[model samples]
Structures are given as structure tokens and as C-alpha cells.
Target: MLRELPVALYCGAFAGMTSPLVAGSYSFIILAGLMSGIILAISKTSFHGFGGKLGTIAFGGVCCVSLIIYILN
Candidate 1:
């Protein structure tokens, strides 16, 4: 996991930008970070070497959590 630490930090940074309106709780950011970590670990080859890959992953994680929060509400 040492090799993936930077990617994980980037993902966490994305999570930090989430708005209180969407998160609605502190756990939302944590959830997004965890989801992004899982995604980063599994999807290294899925996108190959495209630009914006990190952003795409971050977006996916945030969108996923937003969807979950929506459903739970």
C-alpha cells in the first residue's frame, strides 16, 4: 500500500471539497475517502493512462456517497 499512498492522499483531498449541504454529516467525507481508496486500488488499469483519471475517480466516489446519502434520507 506504500506505493498507493499519494493516490490515496489525492483522493482524500477531493473529499475535503465536499459541501456541508451534500455531506450532512462528518462521516460523508470519510466514506468518500474509503470509496476512493477502494476504487484507486482496483481501477489502476481500467482507465489506462488517461488524463483526469484521478478526478474521475474522485468524482465517482463523491457521486456514490451523494447517492447513498440521498437514498438514506
Candidate 2:
């Protein structure tokens, strides 16, 4: 839990900072961060066999942001 705080913060900040320049989708940024955190937690607990935890979090964040932006536009 505590170990993933930095991951969450980094993902949130990255998404928040880039969302405006990317597409001005602030809501998607927040959603991306939350989704990434949830994914990290779940992956850490359930699927601890591949990609490690940080990789999973980062992948989840990027995928969520991309999906949201694609869907919105």
C-alpha cells in the first residue's frame, strides 16, 4: 500500500500535467490516475507473476489515459 504511493502520485501528476496539452480532458486525467492506482493494487495482490508491480501500474495508467482520450475524441 505505502510502497505504491509514489507510483500513484507520479501517474496522477503525469496525467494531470499532460491532459491539458494532450486534449484538455481533465476528467480523464483523474480517472486515469485512479484506474492506475486500482490496477496497481489489484495486480500487486492478485497477479504477482509478470511485469512486476511498477510496470503494471505504469502500463495501466498509460492504457487508461489513451483509452479515455481515444473515446473522448
Candidate 3:
């Protein structure tokens, strides 16, 4: 929850700042952040004891954004 807030904010801000250079697919970054947050939230509740879950969620989120951008462009 609170522990991941900084990471989310940093990732979201970075995504937004660099979005214009990403072939005009800015929304993907925001969506990625939102999706990452959602996935993390779900993972937290579903896999409380799991290890390295945040990293996995973050990677998945970034991968999703990349895929969307690649497909769109």
C-alpha cells in the first residue's frame, strides 16, 4: 500500500514526462501506471506471502505498456 506509493508516483511521472517522445502513445503510460497499481493491489491481497511480487507486477505493467505502444505504432 503505502510502501509502493513512491514507486508508483515516480513511474507515473516518468512515464508521463517521456510519453510525448513515444510515438504519441502517451495514454499507454498512464494506463500502465493504473494497471500496475491495480495489479499490485490484487496481488497484495491474493498473494500476501509471495516474494518479489512487486517487481513482477512492475515488470508486467511495463511490458504491457511496451506491447501496447509497439502494436499501436
Per-residue accuracy of model 3 over 1-73 as CA lDDT, tens digit each: 6887886675455445443555256566668777777776666557677775666676677667778768997
Model 3 ranges with Cα > 4 A deviation: 1-31
What lDDT does candidate 1 reach at residue 44?
Answer: 76
Where's the lowest-lDDT run of ten residues in candidate 3? 14-23
Candidate number of the best TM-score: 1
How would you encode candidate 2's per-residue C-alpha lDDT over 1-73 as one tens digit per residue? 6886776687556545553555356666667677777766666566555545555575567677788668987
**Per-residue lDDT over 15-58 for candidate 1, one digit per residue giving the tens place of the 0 to 100 score:** 76788877777788899988877888888778776888887788
Q: Give candidate 2 misplaced runs (Cα > 4 Å).
A: 1-7, 14-23, 46-56
Model 3 backbone overlap count:
0
TM-score: model 3 vs. ground truth: 0.54
- The full ranking of all candidates by TM-score, starting with the best, is 1, 3, 2
lDDT (Cα, 0-100) at 46 in candidate 3: 75
Estimate candidate 3's alpha-carbon lDDT, on a 0 to 1 scale: 0.64
Off by over 4 Å in 1: none
The 10 consecutive residues of candidate 1 with the worst lDDT sum are 15-24
- Which predicted model would earn the best lDDT? 1
